[model samples]
Target: MSQSNLFIVMSIIAVISSQPVRGKDCVCELQNSESAFPESKLSRVEITALECIRNISSEKMTEVDRLVLGLQHRLQQLNENVSMLEKEDNGNLYGAVSLRIIQLELAEIQDLLDKLGTTNTNNQQLSTEMADQLRDMKYTIAELENFDHTMVVLKDQENQRIKRHLKLCEEELNATSPPPTPTMGNCGLGQMVNVSGAKTYSLTVYGTSYSFGAWGRDANPVPGDENKYWLVVLSSSNVFGHFVRQYNSLSTILLGIGPTDTHISSSNPTTNTIQGPNMVMYENALYYNCYNTLNVCKFNMTTRTVTNVALPNDAGFNNKFPFAHLASAYSHTDMDFAADESGVYVIYATTSNFGNVVISKVETSTPPVLSQTWSTTLHKKTVTNTFMVCGVLYATRYLDKDTEEIFYSFDTKTNTERYDWRIHIKKLQTNIKFLNYDPRDHLLYVYSDAYILTYEIMFR
Candidate 1:
C-alpha cells in the first residue's frame, strides 16, 4: 500500500483497539447535578458534561412520568373520596386547586418532559457517535513524526467539522430548554403606608410583569429612629419571608418559605400568599399576611430571621384552606389593611356577615390580643381593598347610593361614624385605578396603564 494509505490503515486499527475492555469511569457516577462547570473549555470535559446533561435530562423525564402517574392516581382516589364526601361529608378548595390548577400544571410538565426525553435520547446517540469520531481522529493524529501535506489538509477539514457539529448541538440544547417563570405575587406591592415616616424610600416589593405589570422598589417612609424596611414574598411555594436591607444599599431575601405554622401540611403545595409583593414592617419586626390563613409571622431584621407570631385571633385558624384572592381591577368594596401606632385595621370584603363595607380593627394595645372590632355590614354597592397612610385608612369602595362610580378613602377614623358625611370627600382620582402606598415618600401612588398619580397627605 502507499505510505499515506498504510498510515490510515494503522490508525483505524489503533482506534478499534483502544475501545475499553472495562474499569473506565462510569459516566453516571460523575453526574452533572453535583456542580456546574459553566466556563469549561476542554473538549473531553465538555463531552463528559454533554453526556452528563443527557443523563440529567433523562432523570428529569423519569420524574415527570412519575408525577403524571401520581396525578392520575390521585385523581382516581380523589374521585372516590369525593363520592364518599357527597354521601357522608363535604368538599373543599383542597381538591379545587388540585383538580383545576395542579393537574393542568402536571400535564404541562409532562409535555415538556416527553419532549426532553426524546431530545435527550437523540443527544445521547449523537454524543456517542461524536465520541467515537474523536477516538478515530486521535488515532489519525498518532505517529505524526513528520509534516505530511495531504494529512495536514485533512486534519484542518476534520477540525472545522467538529467545531460546526459542536455549535449545532449546543444551539439545539439551548433552544429546547425551558425558562423559569417566577410566581411573585403582589405581596407587599399594592398596599400603601409611609413606612417609618420617610419621603425618600419605600417598603415595596418587585412584582412580575404579568401581575402589577410594573415591578420596582417602591418608596416608604425611610427608616428613622433605627427602624428598617422590607419587601416580602413567598419562597419556592413553601416559604414565606421578606427582603430587607442587609447593609448600605444592598438587599437580601430571608426566611425559608415555610408554612404559616404547624397547621400547614409538610407536602409542599402551590399557592398565592399575596396579591402583589405586599408586606408590612413595624416596631423593628416584620409581619406578613398568609392571606388565606391570615397567618402572620414576626421577623427581626437585626437578627436576619423570623418567628411565628400567632395572635389569639388567628390561633383558631386551621391553615388548611387558602384565603380568597383579590381581583386585579378596581373594585370599591375590596378592603385591605394597614397598621400604625394605634392598631392594625383590616378593610372588609363583602362577606354576608359583614354586609358590604366591613371595617375591622385589632388594637396593638394591651389586652385580648387584637379584637375583631366593628364587623358591621356594608351598605355600599361595591368596594375595593383598604390601605392606611399616616393612620388614615383609604378604601376604594363603591358608593352606597351610586354604584356606577368608585370612590376613595373609607377612613376608619371618619367613616366608622357618619355615613353620608364621610362618603362626600373630594374624589382623589376620578377613574381611580391601581393604588399603592409609597411609605418612603408618604404619598399614595395610583397607577393604571395610562396614568401614574401620586397623592400627598395634606391633613394626616
Candidate 2:
C-alpha cells in the first residue's frame, strides 16, 4: 500500500472509532481502501447520532410529562368526588348507591396509578405526589367499603318483594283507623336527656371467641322471671345464635356462673335460629330476626315454639343497611329489637324509605303482627345502634373507639324527631354489636365485642 493510502486508512479508522455508535445504524459509508474518505459524511454521521439521542430523550420526557398531567387531572376529579360525597353524607339516604359509583371511580384511579408506576421517569416530586394522592383515595375507599353496602344490589326478586310489602303497608295503614296517639305510659323518667357513662363492664360468661352477642334482662318479664338475665352468644359466623343462656340474676352473670342454656334450634344456622346479634327478652319470649328471612321471630321460652311475622318486604336485611362506622360493620344487624315501657318494637331500615330508620310496633299477639309502623328521617347506615325509651326511638353514632354519641331521636308519640341531642356513652370496646334500652331498670345494655357494658339513663 502507498504511504498516503495507509495514512488515509488510519484517519478513517480513528474518525469511525471516535464517532458515537448508535445501535444498529450505519454511521459512516464504506469506501475502497484506495478511495478518499469524505470528512462531511463523517461529520454528518456524528451529528445524526447525537440528534437521535437527543430526540429519543426528549420524546421520553414528554411522555412522562403527559402521564404526570393525566394523573394530576384524575386526582383533581377524585378530590372533587370525595368532597361531594362528604357533603352528601349528612343524610346519606343514598349512601350505598353513591359508594358504588365511587368504587368504580376508584378502580379507574387505581388503573392509572398502576400505569404511572410502570413508566420510567426522573420527576420524583411529581411521582411522589401522585403516589400519595392515590394512597389517600384508596384509604377513603376502604373506609367507605367497610359499610358493607354491597347488599344494595337488589335482585329482581327482592325488588318485587319490596314492592309488594310497600303495597301491603300502604293498604294496612289505610284500612285501619289511625292508631291512638302514643303516650309515655308508665315511664316516670321524663324525656331521656342524658345517658351516663358505663356503670359496669363485664366479659361474657362464655368467652371472647364469640365476638358478637346480647345480654339483658327481659324488659317485660313474667311474674317469676323478672330478675332473669339472658345471654345469647352467636355461635355461628358471629351472626347466628341457636340458644339462650339464662342466668338467675345480674350477680350470677357478673360472677360468670349458673347459665342455663336453652336451644332454640337443633343446628346453629338452621331455620328459626337468631339471624343477628340483636334480640330482646320481653314477657317470657325472645324477639329477634329469623334466619334467612325478613320476618321477626318470637320464641316463647315457655313453650319452646317459634312464631314469625313478615316485616315489610322493603326492609333491609342480611347486612343491607347494618349499623356501621368508619372502621368496620357488624354484619346482619339489620333488625334491632327494643322494648320500652309500652311494648316490644323492631327497628330497621327499608329500601322504600331509602335506608332511613323505620320503627314498627310488634303486637304481642298469637303471631306477633306489626300493628303500627313509623318512619324516621334518620339514615340507618349512619347510626351504630338504636333503642327505645318511652316510645322514643334513640339513635347512636360512633364517636370514637371508646365512645358513642346518642345524637338523634324520634318520638313515636308525637311523630316528631330531633337531631341535636349530644348524650354520650362510654364503651368497653371499639364496636358495639348490640345495644338496647331495657325499661325494666331504665338501663342501657350494650354488647360490645363479646363484652357487656351497662349504662344508666337519666331524664330531664
Candidate 3:
C-alpha cells in the first residue's frame, strides 16, 4: 500500500461519514443546483391537482342527476297520458287520435332514456330503474299500437257487415209490400201538436240512486197483462242493468209499491243485459239495447230467453252519437227502442248518414229482423230523446231543467222531415234519460233523473 493511496482512501471515508446517516423514517430534502425545492409550491400543486379531479367528478354527477330527473318527469307524464286514453276510449272511434298521441309521447320517452343511459353510465342502480321504466313504457306503447290495429280490423269487419246488411235490406224491401201510411184508422191520434205537463211523476222504487231508467206500460200487451207496467232502472254507473221490474198497474208503480215480478236479463254485464236507459215493453217481451254491442235485444218474459238482431253496421253505439246537450251527454244511449201504433222501431244515428237520425222497423219475429230503414237529416246528437208515435219519429231537445221542446219530426210513412216544430214538453228534472211512447195508453213515459213521469200527447 502506497502512502498517497492510503491518504486518499482515508479522505473519502471521512467525507462519506460527514454526510450523515439516514434511517427509514428520515426524509431527504431535494434541491436544485442553486437552492432547495420549495415545499409550499409542491403542496400547492398537489392540492390543485386533487381539486381539479373533484370538480370534474362533481360535474359529471350533476349531469347524470339532471338526466335522471328529466327521465322521471317524462315517465310520469306518459303514465298520465295512458290513463286519459283508457278513460276516453269509446268504442275505439277516438282511439286513432289517442294512439297517435301516445306514440309521439313514447318516442320522446325513448329519446330521454337514451340520453340517460349515455350520461349516467356509472350508476348501476339508477341505470336499472331507468331501464325498467323504459321497458314499461314500451309495453304500454305496444298495447296501444295493438289496439289501433284491432280497431282497423274491426272497422274492416264492420264495413263488410254493412255491405251484407245493405244487400239484405234491399232484398227485404223488394220482397215486402209498400209500407203503410198513417191514417185515422191505424193511428186515431193525428199529428202531435203539443205535449201536456207531467200527469204522473214518481221516483223509482229502488230510490233516486238509479239516476237513469225507463218505465212504461206494454204497447202490445198480452190479454191478461194489459195494465202491466215495466221499469228498467240502470245500475252500475248508470250504464248497465240486469233486471226489469214489473207492476200490476200504474197505480201500483205511482204508489212505489214493490214490484209484482222481476225479470233477470243477465247475471253479469257480459251476457244479455240492458246497456242503455232506453228500453220498451211490447207485448210480452222487453226490447232494449244489448250489452256492449250494436244490437236490439228481445228478452221474452214468458220463456226467459234472449234474442238479438244486429242493427245496421253504420249505426253508432257506445256513446259515439249519444244523446247530448250543452251541459252533459247521456252515455250508451245510441239505440232508442220506441213503440208506435205501427210496430216496434229502433231510432239511432249512423256514421254513413253523417250522424243523422235513422229509423228502422223491427219485426218481432224470430231473431227480430230489421224490415225497413229510413235515414233523416236530423242530427241525433242534437236531440236529447226521441219517440215513435203513429209511425212518426219525433225528436226533442232540452230547454231547461223543467222543459223539453219537441223541435224535430220525421214521418216514416211519408219520408218527410220537419225541424221547426217547437212543441215543448214540461219535465220534472233536467235530464231525461229515457222517453218512449206507449201506443196502447197514448202516453209519453219519460225516465228523467231517477224520476218516472207520464205525459199525455195532444194531437191536431
Candidate 4:
C-alpha cells in the first residue's frame, strides 16, 4: 500500500475512535430486563404501596358487607319489636318506645347507605351487592310505612303514638345532651350548640364588621392576652386584617396589628395579586400559599414585612384557578396549611409520588425553610377538606346537606393510618367551606358559603 493511502486510513480510524459510540433510543423493556436481573429493580416503598392497595380493597369490601348486615339485623329486630307491641293489650305504652327505636335505627341505616353510595368501590361484585342491599333497605322502609298506616289501635292509642313520638323527638332535639351520655358520645353527632341552628357569627373588627376569607388563628392564644385569640384574615386586596377574640365570644374584634389594609408584596407588584384558600398562624407570623406563584408567604405582624418561600416544583398548588376559591371548587383542595401540636406544616399534593400527600414542616425563618417531609397515602382528589387536630390529620367528604363524614385520618404521633373513623359532623347544611378547631376554646368554627358557624366541643 502507498504511504498516502496508509496515512488517510490511519486518520479515519483515529477520528472514528474518538467519536463516542451512540446507541439507538432504547425503550424500557422491563419484562426482558427482569429476566436478566429479576431482584435488582424491586423498591421497598413500591412494595409497601402495593400491599397497602391490596389490603385497602379487601378491607373496604369486608366493611361494606359488615355494615349492610348490621343494618339489616337492626331493622329486623325493630320490625319484630314493633309487631309484638301491636299485638299486646298494653301495646300503646310500648308502641312509642318501639317507634322511637325504629326511627333511630332508620337514621343510622340511612347514613350508612349514604356512605356506601359515596365509596369508590371498583369491584363489580361488591358494587352489585351494595345496590341490592340499598334496594332491600328501601323495601324495609316501605314496609315500615305500611305497618304504621294500617295498624289497628284504640282512639287513645292513636293519640299515644303522637304523644310518645313527640316526647322522644323532644329528647333527641335537645342539644344539651352532654358528652358523657353513652347514646350520644360516639353517635357521630358532636354536641349541638345552644345558639341558633345557624353556626355563623360575623367578624367585627375595627368597630365595623368586615368579611374576609382564608383565615389563620394563633397556635396558642397571644402572649399576655389569656383568653384572647389572635386571628388574621386575608382579603382579596392582598391585605392581612388582624383580629382578637375573648374566650367565650364568637365575635372577632380587630387588634389593629398592621395597616388596616396591609398589602402583601407580590412578585408582580400589581394591585391584582391572587389570594389562596388556606393559611396557618404560628407565634406571631402568618404563613400562606400564594396562588399563582405557588410560594409560601410568611407575613410577620411585628416587622410588617412579607417573605416568600418557593415550594418544590411539583407542589400541586392549584395555579390553574383564576380567582380565589373561598366557598368551594372542583379542584380547590390542592394544598392546605395546618398547625398541629408540634408545629405548622403545609400539606400539599404532588405529582412526583403518584397521587400522594407530601407534608413539609415549615420553620419560621426569614424565608421559611421546609424542615422535614412526610409522605401520606391520601390522594388529594378524594378529600373535600382537611384539618389537623392535635397531631392527627383528619379528612372530610361531603355526604349530604347535614353530614360531613370523616373518611380518612393519619396520626403523625403514633404513625398510624385509619380509613374509616366514622366520625361525622351533623349540621343544618353542607355548604361548609372550611372548618377549624381552636383547642384553646374547644370550638370548631365552620366557614360556610356566606356566613361563619361556631360550635362548642364538649369533652366528657
TM-score of each: 0.34, 0.60, 0.59, 0.48
Q: Looking at model 1, which ten-residue stretch has the lowest summed lDDT?
A: 247-256
Write the number of the candidate with greater TM-score, choosing between 1 and 2: 2
- Candidate 2 residue lDDT tens string, 331-392: 99898999988999999999899999999999998689998999988888898999988888
Q: Which stretches of candidate 4 lie above 4 Å from their native place?
A: 1-212, 225-249, 252-261, 265-274, 319-333, 457-460
Backbone clash pairs for candidate 3 read 220-283
Superposing all C-alpha atoms, what RMSD in Å does each candidate have to the true structure? 26.5, 26.0, 30.2, 28.7
- Write candidate 3's Cα lDDT for 18-72 as tens digits: 7766763334343333334355544554565555455456446556555555556
Model 4, span 250-318: residue lDDT tens: 122222222234344534323223344466667767677655567887777567667777778876765
Compute the lDDT of residue 454 as modeled in candidate 3.
81
Q: After superposition, how far is residue 188 of candidate 3 from its true place, in Å?
A: 3.9
How do these models rank on TM-score, best leading? 2, 3, 4, 1
Best by lDDT: 2
Candidate 4 versus truth, CA RMSD in Å, comes to 28.7
Flag regions of model 1 displaced more than 4 Å. 1-210, 213-229, 233-278, 304-335, 340-343, 350-355, 363-368, 376-381, 389-392, 397-441, 445-454
TM-score of 3: 0.59
True lDDT of residue 113, candidate 1: 59
Candidate 2 weakest lDDT stretch, 10 residues: 145-154
Q: By lDDT, is 1 or 3 better?
A: 3
